[model samples]
Target chain A: MVSALTCLFTPLLRAAELQSSLIASALWSGDSHNFKRQSHQFSLEPEAILRFDNRVKLTALMRLRSISFDGLAPQRVSDAAYSPLGKPLYMGNSSEFELREFYLELPSDNYYFTLGKQQVVWGKADGLKVLDIVNPQSYREFILEDFDDSRIPQWLANIETNVGEWDAQFLWIPEQSYHVLASEGGLYAPTSPLLLPQAPPVGVSVDVKAIDRPGRLLMDSDIGLRLSRFWKGWDLSLNYLYQYDNFALLYQDRSLTANGPHVTIQPQYRRTHVLGGSFSNAFDNWVLRGELAYFSDRYFLAEGLSDSDGITKGKEVSSVVGLDWTGLENTLISGQLFQSVALNRQSATVRDKSESTLSLLVNHTLLNDTLELRLIWLTNSNVGDGLMRLRVTYEWQDNLKTWASSDTFYGSEEGIFGQFDDNDRLIIGIELAFE
Target chain B: MKYPRLLSCWVGILSTPFFALTGLAQEPLSNAQATLPTGGQVAAHINSRDEGEAVSRKLSIVMRDKRGKTRKRETMSYRKYYAGEKRTVIFYLAPKNIRDTAFLTYDYNTPEREDDQWLYLPALRKVRRISAADRGDYFLGTDMTYEDIKLETRVSTADFNFKTVGNCDVDGHPGLHIEGTPKTQAIARELGYSKSLSCVDRQIWMVRQSQFWDIKGALLKTVTIANIDQIQGIWTQQNINVENHKTGHSTSLSFAEVDYQSPVPDTMFTTNAIKRGL
Candidate 1:
C-alpha cells in the first residue's frame, strides 16, 4: 500500500510539524429496485500536510476504494462516456490508488503563490454550489460524499495579494481535465433507453467508436480571478473564470469505411466565460448568504438526436440564497434556494428555461453533545424530484465518529433523483483522523 | 469537533466587568453596602486601571452532570476590544475529536442589535452562520444558558432597579452585595429573571459572585469567580464555576496561559480565518 511508502517520508518531512490522518470507512448498501442485490464498500483515505520554514507548504492526499457485492452486474459499454477511473478496479472490487491533492504554497509579504493541483472553493451557500467552481467533480456518488472528497483537484498556479483593503486571487491552469462521469452500469449512472430523434438509418454492422480529449496542454487552459473584501459585517466577492466544461458534449467525426458509413464519437469542450459574485452578512442570530454566476457560450447536449451528434451553444445564469438560524435549543436550521435560468432559450433545449431548487437542513444535539441528529432534504421544482437524507452520528472523541445514515429519493425516471429511484441506500461508517 | 465550539456553547464573550455596573440597576443596601464605595466611583476606578485592547488565553472547561460525571474540554482564544467593537475567535485544541474546530464572534455596541457568530465544522468542510438568541436556552446542555451568558448585554438600567444589600467577604475579598429586580413584569419574563444578586470586589470593582432568582422566587443558579490575578495590567479571573440548582448541573471554566495585549492578527478574528482553520 502507498500508505506504507508515505510513512517512510513522515520523519523527514515533519521537522516543520507534519500533520496527517488516516480515515477508513465501510458501508453495506441495499438497492430499492432489487432487495436481493446488495453491495458493500470500503474506502481508505490518507492525507498529510507539511509547512517548511522555507516559506513553502505541501499537502498530499490519496484514497483507495473497494466494493464487494452479490449479483452485481458487469460494466456496461453502451455509452462510451463511462469514466476510466469511475469504474471499480477490483481484486474483487478495489479502486486503483488515487492521488487527490499534492501542492506547494509559497507565501510572502506582498503576494503568495500556490503551485500544483488543488481545489479552489469560492461560495458560502450550503449545498448550492452557485459559485463553488474552479475544479471538476466526480458525481459517481451524486451528492452523498462531501465535496472536499468529491471535488477533483486540478493542476494550476494561484496567486493572492492584498491591495489596500481589497484582497484579490488569481488562478491559471495549464492542463484541462473534464469531469469524470459515473462508470456505465455503476450505482449512480443514468439508466434509461433513449430513441434518437433524427438520424440516417445505419447498417446494423456499422461500428461507432470514441476519440479521447485534447492532449496538448496549452490548447485547453483555464484561468480565473476573484476580488473580495469584508466590510461592515458583510463579506463580498466578485469573480471571473474562463474554463472548459466539466461535462463533455459529443460530436460526430465522419469516416469512410469499407462496410459503409462509419462514425467516430469525439468529446468536445466549449470554452466558457463565467462571471460571478457572492455576499455574506452576519446579523443577530442569523447568517445570510447569496451567490450568482453567469455563463457565456455554455454548451448543451442535443438530447433525443440519436442519428447525428450535435452540440448547442447557450447562456446560463445561476443563483442561490441561503440562511442559517441557531435560535432553538441546541438546534441549527439552515435552508437554501437555488435557481438557474437559461439565458438563451433556443440553444438550450434539453432543459427547461428555468429551474428552481430548494434544500433544507436541520441538526440537533443530545446527551451533552455526544450524539447528533441531522436531516437534509433537497427538491427540484422543475422535475418534481427530490432526495431526503438522514444521519445520526455519535462522537466517541474529537477525532472519531460513528454514523448511520439513510438516503431516499423520489421522482420520475428522467429526473435526477428519478433515474436512481431504486438505488436508495443505508450507510454506516466510522471515520478517525490523527496527526 | 470540540463539543463546546461546535455547539457554540459557553463562548464567554465577556466585556469589561467594571463597565457592567455603570448602567441602570436597582435596590437598597445594608450597612455593609453603606461602608463600600458607590458603584459609580468603583466603576470609574476600574476603568482607569490598566486595560489593554486585546487578550489571549488557554481555557480548560469542564461540565458535570447531576451524578458528578464530568466532560473536559480545552481551547485557545484571541480577543480584541475596540471602543464599540469586539471580535473573538476560539480554537479547540484538545479532546481530539473536536480539535481544530474554530468559532468566531462579533459583538456590536448597538443596543437594538445582537451579536453575530459563526462556527467552522471540519467534517462538513463548511463554516456555518450560527444564529444565537439571548433566550433561556442552555449552551450545549451546559448549566449556563444564552441568557445567562449575555447577562450584561440583555439587561439594562431601564429594565431593572438596583440596591445595595450589605458588606460581605467574597472569595476572601472585601465586597459589596447588590440586588436588582426587573422594573416590569415584561422585562422579568424577557430575562427569565425576577431578581439578580451579586457581590462586587470593592477594590477592583469586579464581580466575584452572582445569583439568579426565577419569577416564582426560587433560586435558579449561582456563579462564583476565583483565582484572581493581575495579568497584562488588568484584573482577570482565572477560574469561574456555575451551579444550576434546579437542574443539579454545573460547569466550570478555568483559564491558563493567559496573555494580555498579545500580537493577535486582526485577520484571526474573522469568519474567513475561521474557515481556514487552525
Candidate 2:
C-alpha cells in the first residue's frame, strides 16, 4: 500500500529537490533483580523519513520486541510480579510487535498539516501528571497488555497556521478508543483486579460488566492557540487548549464494588470537555513554566453505559509549576510541583482525593556530549512515598550507545499479608544504529 | 530598532552632499594632479575605514532557500579584525551554540596571508583549531563566509579617478559624496569594483555607502553605512545594511552596545587560548 504512494510521489519529490532516508536500529538490555532473578531483552526499531525543500516531512516508525526471563515460565510470569500494574510489561522487549508512528505531513510557507497515527502533547508534564507523556502506545501494546497503553487514536488530523504573532492549531480525531484490558482466558475478562493490601493477590478478581458494550467509536476535537513574544530579555509563550470528546460518558458509568475476593463494576458512557492553559518564560538563564487543565465529567470515559440519571458529574483540575536554573554552562537544575483535584463533585458518593507531587532533577554533560548524567527525586503527597532515579547515558555516534539507570521506591504499602519492601530496580542497555 | 534610528541619521548625513555640491558654488580645478592624488587617497582611506571596523552588537540573520523556507543550523559565527603590523581584533562574537568561537588573521595583504581559527566547547573544556583556507567557506552555519568579514585590500589597489559628487546629510550628519573608478584594468579587475561607486564623507573621509554592479551593469548589492559614531577619536560604523537587489533579502547589523577601545589581551587570540577553552 505504501509502495504505490511512494512510487507516485518519488518523481514529485525529485523534481522538488527533496530527500528521503531510512534508518534501522537495535537495542538490548539485561537486568538482575536482588542479584538472583535475571531478564534479557532485545528490540528492533526501524524508521523512514522524508524531507522536502520546503521543510515538509513525513516519517514512519516500527518497533519489534522480544524478551526472555530466567527462573520463571512465560505463562507464569506477569508484569505484577515485577511492578504495581499487573500487566505484561517490557522496557526494550515485548512479545507483541507493532507500528509506532505512521504520519504524513505537508508543511508549506505559512501552514502545516499532519494526518495519521501520531502522539500529540498538549502540555509539559514530563511523566508525573494526568497529562504525563512518558510513552505513547506502540502497536505491540495494542495487541498485548501494558499500563503504558493509555491513549492512541486510530485516526487523527491536525492543522497549524501562523498569523502574525499567534500560532493556532486544530486537531480532529474521527475515531478514538482506549485499549480494552485483555481478558486472561475469557473473551473479555479482566486479567488483574485492583486489590488492597489485605486482599488476596492472585485469586481476587473483578467482574467489569459492560453497560454500553465497552468499545464504541467516538469523535474528538481540540483547538489550541499560542502567543509567542519577547519582552525585556525574556522569551514568553502563552497557550490555551479546548478539547471535546464524546466517549467520556462511557467511562463514567464504570464502578468497582469490593466483595471479599471478588469485585464487580459497570462501565458507562459520558461526555468529556477539557480546557487548559500554559505559560513558559525564559529570562537570564532561568526558565519558568506553569500549566493548568480542567476536565469536565468524562475525561477518560469508555463507551456503552447508562446515563439515565446523569448523576456521575464532576470536574477534575490539574496544575503544574516548574522552574529551571542554568547557572552552569554544562549543568542544569530543575524542579516541578504538581497538584490534581476533583472539583464540583455530584455528591459525597464520589470520593474526591487530590494528588500532589514534587520532583527535583539535575542534569550534566561530560566528554563533549558523549556522556550525560541525570538524577531525579520525586515525592507523592497523597501516597506518602518517594522515588529516586539515577540515569547515566553514553553515546559514541554510530559505534555504541548505552544507558544505565536505577530506580528506588520507598514507603510502599504492605500487600496480601506480606510487607512490600522497598524496590531497588536497575536497568542497563546498549543501542546500535549504524548501517 | 537601533539600526532603524541610525539609518535615518545616516540618510540625513548623505543628503547634505546632494545639496552642497549642487546648491553652493565651488572653484573647479584644472590640473588633474592637484585634485587626483589627495582625492583618491581620501576616497580609499574612507572606504578602508568603513570596512575596517566591525559593525553590530548582535544580529539575527534568517537565511531562506529558494522556496522561502528557513533551514535549521547548529551554529554560526562572525569575526572581523584590522590589518597592520600590530593586529587588532575588531569583532569577535558567535551566536548561541557557536559562542566562544574566535578567528584570527595574519599578513592580511599578502597572497600568503594566514588565518587561524578556534572554537571553544563548554562541554569539553577545549578549543579546536581550524585551517586558514576555510576562510572562504561559510562561517559556522550562516550564509556569510569568512572572506566576507575580512577586508581584502587587493580589491582596492586601483588607481582611482575621484570626483566629488556633492554634499548631503546622512542621518542628520553632513557628509560629502565622492565617486571613484579604477584608472587601470589590473586594479579594476583585481578589486572587483571597477564599475562600482562609493560615497564618502569629506570631513572624516569615511565611505558611507557603496553600490556594486555586475560586469553587465546590473545592480548586485547596495551596502549602505547606516551609522557612524565616534569612539576614542576613531570613527566607527555602528550599523550596516547589505541589500541584495535580486533576492529582496536584506541583512542589517546594528551594534546595540560596543566597547571599541577595550583592552583585548594578546594572549586571548593565541592557539593556547583555543586549546585551554576560550
Candidate 3:
C-alpha cells in the first residue's frame, strides 16, 4: 500500500525539490558526584519533505538510537512504553527504526488539512506544559531533551482555517497513547520516593497487574480546538481539549487470602476536560506572556497509610506568567512564575493544595552567535527543590555544532528534583547535519 | 508604478553609467530641495522614492570574521503594502538546523506607532511575539543592525538631526554629504549610535555610503551599497556590504531573482503564512 501510494505521488513531485536532512550525534554523560560513567548515546535522524506544484506536501522522518551504560553490552529494552496500536518497528535491544512522522498536507483556499502520524503543539508558555498537551511526551530522559525531540507523534488529523480575524485549529487524535516512561531498570528511571509506592508490610505481598490501556478506536480518542487572534498589540488564544490524562492513576485493591494480606495494584488512565487561555504582548524590548488552564476531574494519590483505593479526585487550576527582556546585546533574559492549585483538596490527598515554581533562563550569544551560552534554573517554592542546567554550544560550521552541559538537581529525597540529586551528570555532545 | 515627475530623472540616473547632474533639463529644486537642499529634504527624498508596490526576492547574507571564517544564510523575502502600512515576511531556506524558521514584521509609517513583529520557530512549533524596538541590535549574527535591514536606503528623520555638510564624490558619482546626530540622549541610546555621515547620490536620491560612530563616539562601521538595478522601471539596491571598523567583522548581502511585477498577496504577510513556511 505504501509503495503504491509513493508511486502515484512520485510523478507529481520534482526530484530536486524534495528537501532532505540527515543528522548524526554522539553524547556521553557521567555522574557528577561519583564521577562514574552513566550512559553513552548515539542517534541518527533522517528527514525528507516533498512539495508539489499543486501545494500538496509530504514529510517523513526516520530515527535510530542506541544507548548503553558504562560501555556495557546493550540491555534488553521493553516496548511497553509505546502504544500497542501504533508501535513502531524495533530492531535489536538497542535499535529502533521508526517512521516518526509521515504526514501529508493538503491546503485549500483558506483552509489547511494535515493527516497522518504527526505532532501538534499548542501553547504560549516557554519550557513549560499547559495547553501544549495535545500530544503525549516521552519521559525517558526526564524532560531533559528539547520538546521537539521528546514529543511522541501519533496518527491524527488536523485542520486549520481563518475565521474572520482569528485562526482556528481543530484536531482529532485517534491514537491512544500516553506518556512513555523509562524502563524500571533503565538509566533514567525515577527513584524518587514521592513517585514510588511504599514497601509492602513484612507479612504482606504485593502483586502488580498490567496497565489497563484504552484500546477502543473512536470511544477513546482525543479531540482539541484552539482559536487565536492578534488584536491591538496583544496575541490572545482560547483552547479546549477532551482527552485522557497523560499520567495514569494507581488503583489498589487489598484482600486477605490464603496468601495472607495480598495487595493488587492496577494503573488506569482517567478522562479530563481542559479549558485554557493565553495572551502575549510586547512592550519595547520586553515581552509579557501568560497562560492559565482549568482541569476538571484530576486524580491524585491518597496520603493515608491505610486507604482502600489509594486515589483522590479533585479539580485543578494551573497558571503561568512570564517576561522576556532583550535589552542587552545578543542576550535574552526570561523569567516565569507558575502555580497550580487543587480547588477541592482532600484531607488524605498526598498532593499539596497549592504548588508554585519559578524558572529563570538567560541566553547570550558571542562571536557573532558562533559561541552560545545558556543557563536555566527551575525552583519549586514550596519544596525548595529545583534543577539547574548550564550549557555552552559552539557552531563549528554551518549545520554543525558542539556542546557541553551540566545538569544539577537539588532537594530532599522525597522532592522531585531531590530524587535525582545523585543522578547529576555532565554531558558533551557533537552533532552534524547535512541538507 | 511610475511617477511622471520622477520618471525623467530616474531613467537618466539608472540607465547611465554615472549619475552626473550635467546636461539634463535643469529642473528647479522643489521648496524642500532648494538651491542647497537641507538634510531633511535629502532624507525625505530617499524615503518617498518609489521602489515598488510589492517585491519578492531571494536574499543571501554572508558574515565573515577577522580570521576569514564565513557563514552564509539564505532566505526568501516578501514585502507588501497594506493601506499605507508596510509588511514584510522572511523565511529561511537553507542550513538545515535553522530551516523552516520565519519572521514577520508590520512596519507603520508613523514613527510614534510601535511596529509589530513575530518569529515562528519550527523546532518549538510556536510563534513568539517579538518587540521591534531593538532596532539597533545586530540581526542573525550579521554586521547589519535590525534598522539597517528594515530601512535599506532610507533614514529615520525623527530620530536624528540632519545637516547638509558639503559635496562628496563616491565611486565617481557626485553626491551630497550629510551629517546626522541623535535628537536626544534617549534616541542615541536606543539607536546605539552617536553620529553618522551619509553620502546621497544627487541624481538618484539614494544613500550610497554611510559611516557610523558608536555611542562612545568611536568609529563603528561603514556600509556601502552597490549593484544598483532598474527592475521593472524601479531602482533597487541589489548588493549591500557592511564592515565593522572596530571588530574587523563584515557582512554582505546579495539580492537574487528580484521580482517586482510578481503577484504578492496580502495574506502572505500574515503570521499564518509564515507558520506554514515557504
DockQ ranking of the models: 3, 1, 2
lDDT value, residue A191 of candidate 1: 52
lDDT of 1 by residue, A161-202 (tens): 887788889999775666665555667765532111134366
**How do these models rank on lDDT, best leading?**
3, 1, 2
Candidate 3, residue A374: CA error in Å?
0.4
> In candidate 3, what fraction of native interface contacts survive?
0.70
Give the alpha carbon lDDT tens digit for every residue of B1-278 in model 3: 00000000111112111111222112334555446788878777877788787889888878789999887878888877767588878887878866777877888888888888888888788888877777667766777666666665567787887877666767877777777888899878877788887777888887777778889988887777788778888888787777788889988878889898999987788777888887
Compare the candidates by DockQ and give the number of the best one: 3
Q: What is the TM-score of chain B alone in each candidate?
A: 0.79, 0.57, 0.86
Docking quality tier of candidate 1?
A: acceptable
lDDT of 2 by residue, B49-83 (tens): 54334322333343343344442211122224545
The residue-by-residue lDDT of candidate 3 on A1-435, one tens digit each, is: 999998986777554368889999998888888866677889899999988787788999988877776222222322454676556566566665667899999998888999999989877777778778988887766778889887889999999998998899999998988877665666556666456566677999888888888888899999899999889889999999999998877788888999799888998899999999999999999999999999998877777654578877889999999998888877788899999898774546766788888999888888777788999999888789999999999988888899999999998767777777777889999999988
Model 1 DockQ vs. reference = 0.38
lDDT tens per residue, model 1, B1-278: 22232422333312112112212232346554476565444434433544457777787778776887676778777777767867778787655456567877776767456667677776555665555453445655466654444332122444456555556566468776656677789657655667776666768766677677777877877777777788867788787777777867788888888788668777778665675555
Best-matching candidate per TM-score: 3
TM-score of each candidate structure, all chains considered together: 0.83, 0.50, 0.92
- For candidate 1, what is the lDDT? 0.66
Error of 2 at B212 (Å): 37
Tell me the fnat of candidate 1.
0.44
